[model samples]
Target: MVYDTVVIGLGPAGSTVLYHLAGRGFRVVGIDMARFPRYKSCGGCISVKVGELLDFDISHLIEHTVYGATFTYRCARMMDIISDEVVGYNIMRDRFDHHLLEQARKRGAEVVEGLRVVDVVEKKGYVEVECDEGRTFKGSFLVGADGASGITGRKVFGMDRRRSAVSVTAEVPYRSEDLGMEIDGRLFIDFGSVPYGYGWIFPKERYLSVGIAGDTLKVGGRIKDFFNTLVRGHTLLKGLRIGERVGWTVPTFYGEMPLPVKGRIALVGDTGHLVDPFLGEGIYYAIKTASMASSVIGDAIESGTPDLSTYGEMLKGEIYPEFTSAERLSDLVYNHPRLWYRMIEKEPEIMYRFYDVIRGKESFGVFYRWIWSKVRSKPWKVLRRWLESRFLPA
Candidate 1:
C-alpha cells in the first residue's frame, strides 16, 4: 500500500516529521529497527527551543535540570559559570525518543517497529522500502532518519559514509552519600581532556552521563584512551563506579554530505550529518531541521510535485549557515585549548555568553565575535570583570 510518506527511523527527527505530516492529515508511516524505549547512546539534553518547536512540555520527562556548568581544563584549571535560570534538562534517550514516537502515532501516523529496512527502491511515482520480514511498503516520499551509519542513507540517497566524530559514553550510578559535594544541579564541560575533543558530565536522577567526543580521523583511534583519561582525570568522578560504556560514530557537517532533500527521498538527523561540529549536539538540530523538512514536504505533497529542492533551499537558508560558523569555531576552540582557557581565566563572564549560545539566546558566531570585541578592548572592562567574578557566585 502506498502512503503519503514512508519514514525510516523512529528517532526524534523522523518521528517528529511523521507527527507534523500526519497532523496535517497526510498518510504517514514510520518504521524503526529498534523496539519502543530502546537504548540510544546520547547525552539526552534538550534545549528550550526544541520544546517550543514541538509545543510539547518535556519538563515532566526531565530527570534533572542544570543551572550552570563547570568548565575544566585537563583536570587542573576550572571555571564555574552559574546562572539563576535553568539551562537545560537532562533526560534519558530511551524515554525521550519513545515519547516523541508515541506522539507521532497518536497524531495518526502508523508505526512499525522491530523491523529493519533491507533495501530501498525509487520507482516512477513512489518509493519502495523492503523490510527484513519480507514486507514491502511504498510511499510518495521517503525520509531516512536511521542515524549516521544506517543503510537508508547510503542505499537510498547514495551518500558516501565517512567519519566525523566518535562519541564514547558511560553512565555512572549516582548515590547521595557517595557524592562529596551537594548536587547543585550543574552540568560539567571538560576541555583539553582529549585530543581534538571534549568531555561532558550531565547529571540525571540516578546516574551521570559522562562521555567524550573527538574528530573521527584524528582521534577516533584513541577514543578508548581518551575516555579512560577522562574518567581517571575527572576530579569529581574519581571514586564513582561507571557502567554501560558504549561508542557510536557521529557525523559532522563538512559539505561532503549533500543536502538531504532530492527526488522523493530526504534524510534527517544523523543520516544527513546534522550534528553540530563544535559541540556534537544533534537532538536540537534534528528536531529543528525536521520541522523545516516537514514544512516543505507538505508543500510538495499538496502541489503534487515530487521535486524536493525546496527543502534543500530552506535548510540552506536556515540551518546550514549556523553549521558553517560552528565548524570554524570548533576548529579554533577545540584546537587551541590554552588560548580559550586563558581567555576565560581573564574574563570568566565569557562563559555566560556560552550559556546564552546553548540556550538559543545567541548564535555561536555572534557570541564569538562579541567575545573578540570584548578582548580587543580589555583595558576598559578589566575592573568590571574582576569585580563581577570576585563578587558573583560563579
Candidate 2:
C-alpha cells in the first residue's frame, strides 16, 4: 500500500514526527523492530523544554523532578547549582518511549511493531521498504529515526560508523530516607573518578540510575571497570543492591552524511548523529529536529513539491550550527581531559556556569566570559602548568 509518509523507528523522534503528521490528517505508517516499552540504555533525564514540546503531562510519567545538578572534579572539588526554575524530569526510557508510541497511534498513525525493514530502494518518484516478513510498503517520503546502527543510516545515508564513549548503566532499587529525600533531587556528576568521561547518579522514585561514560578510544581499560568501581567504591551508593546492568556506546560526533535526504528519504534523530557531546543527551535534539523535519516534509507533500530541497535547507540552517559547536567542544574535552579537571580545580564556580550552558538556562556568552576571566586572572600559571604537564609526562 502507498503511504503519504513512512517513518522507520518508533522512538522519540519517529513518534513525534508521526504524531504531528498524522494529526494533520496525513496517512502515516510508523515502524519499529522492537515491541513497545523495551528497555534502553540511557540516562533517562528529560529537560523541561521537552515536556512543553511533547504536550503531555510529564509530571504523571516522571519518576523524579530534577532541580539541578552537582559537579565533582578529580581534585576533590565540588560545586552544585540550583535551577532558577524546574529544569527537567527524570523518566525510564521503556515507559517514555512506549507512551510516545501510544500517542502516535492515538493520533491516527498506523504503528507496526516487531517488523524490521530489511531492504529499501528508491524509485523514480517513491521509496519501497520491504520488511522481513515479505510485506512491502511504498511512501512518497521516508524518515529514518531507526538509531545509530540502524540500516536506514548505514545503507542509505552512507554515514561511516565510528565509536566514541561507551557507558554501562545500572538501575538499582534502593530505599534510604537520606537517599530518597535528596537535597534538590539533583543529578551528581563525578569527574576524575573515571578518565575522559564522568560518572553520574540520577535519582528516581524507588531506584537510582548509576553509570559512567568515557572515551573508549583513549581509555586503556574496559568500561566495565569504571562501572564496577562506581558501584562498589562510591561512598554515596555503597549500600544499594545491584539490579540490572545495561551498556551502550555513545557517538560523540557526526561527520557530514553523504545525503540527509534522497528521493523520498530523510534521516532524523540518531540516524543523523544528533547526540550531544558533553552530556551525551540526544532525546531533546531528536524530538526537536524530528518536529522540524516533519513540518518541512508535511508542507512539501501537501504542496506536491517532492524535491525535499526545502527540508534539507531547513535542517542545515536549524541543526548544523549547534552540532558543529558541540563537535568542537567534544574534541577539546576528549583531547585534553585534564583541562576540564583543571578548570574545576582552579575555579569550581565555572562548573555550575557550564551546567547552566548545558541545561540551556544560560547563554554561551556567559560561559565564554567566565573562561576569559579565568585565563586573564592567572595567564602564566595556567600556561606553565599546561606546558610542564605536557613535557614532564605521567
Of the candidates shown, which would achieve the greatest TM-score relative to the real structure?
A: 1
Backbone clashes in candidate 2 total 0
Which ranges of candidate 1 are over 4 A from the true structure? 158-160, 372-394
Per-candidate Cα RMSD to the true structure, in Å, reads 4.7, 3.0
Which tens-of-lDDT digit does each residue in 1-394 have in candidate 1? 7999999998999999998999999999999999999988888777656767877666678898777888888876767888887777889999899999988888999999999998889999999999997999999999888987688767766666554888799888988778765556688888877777789988888888899988877884889888998899887787998777899887878766667877898888888888888888899998887888888889899999888888798788878878888887777678766566767877777777777888888887797677656656775565455455456432
**Tens-digit lDDT track of model 2 for 160-198:** 655457788988787766553344568877775566778
Task: Please give the CA lDDT of all the candidate structures.
Answer: 0.83, 0.76
For model 1, what is the error of residue 118's alpha carbon versus the real structure, in angstroms, after optimal superposition? 1.7
Alpha-carbon shift of residue 46 in model 1 (angstroms): 1.2
Q: Which residue runs of candidate 2 sit more than 4 Å off their true CA positions?
A: 74-78, 178-183, 255-259, 345-348, 361-373, 385-394
The residue pairs found clashing in candidate 2 are none
TM-score of 1: 0.92
* Global Cα lDDT for candidate 1: 0.83
Summed backbone clashes in each candidate are 0, 0
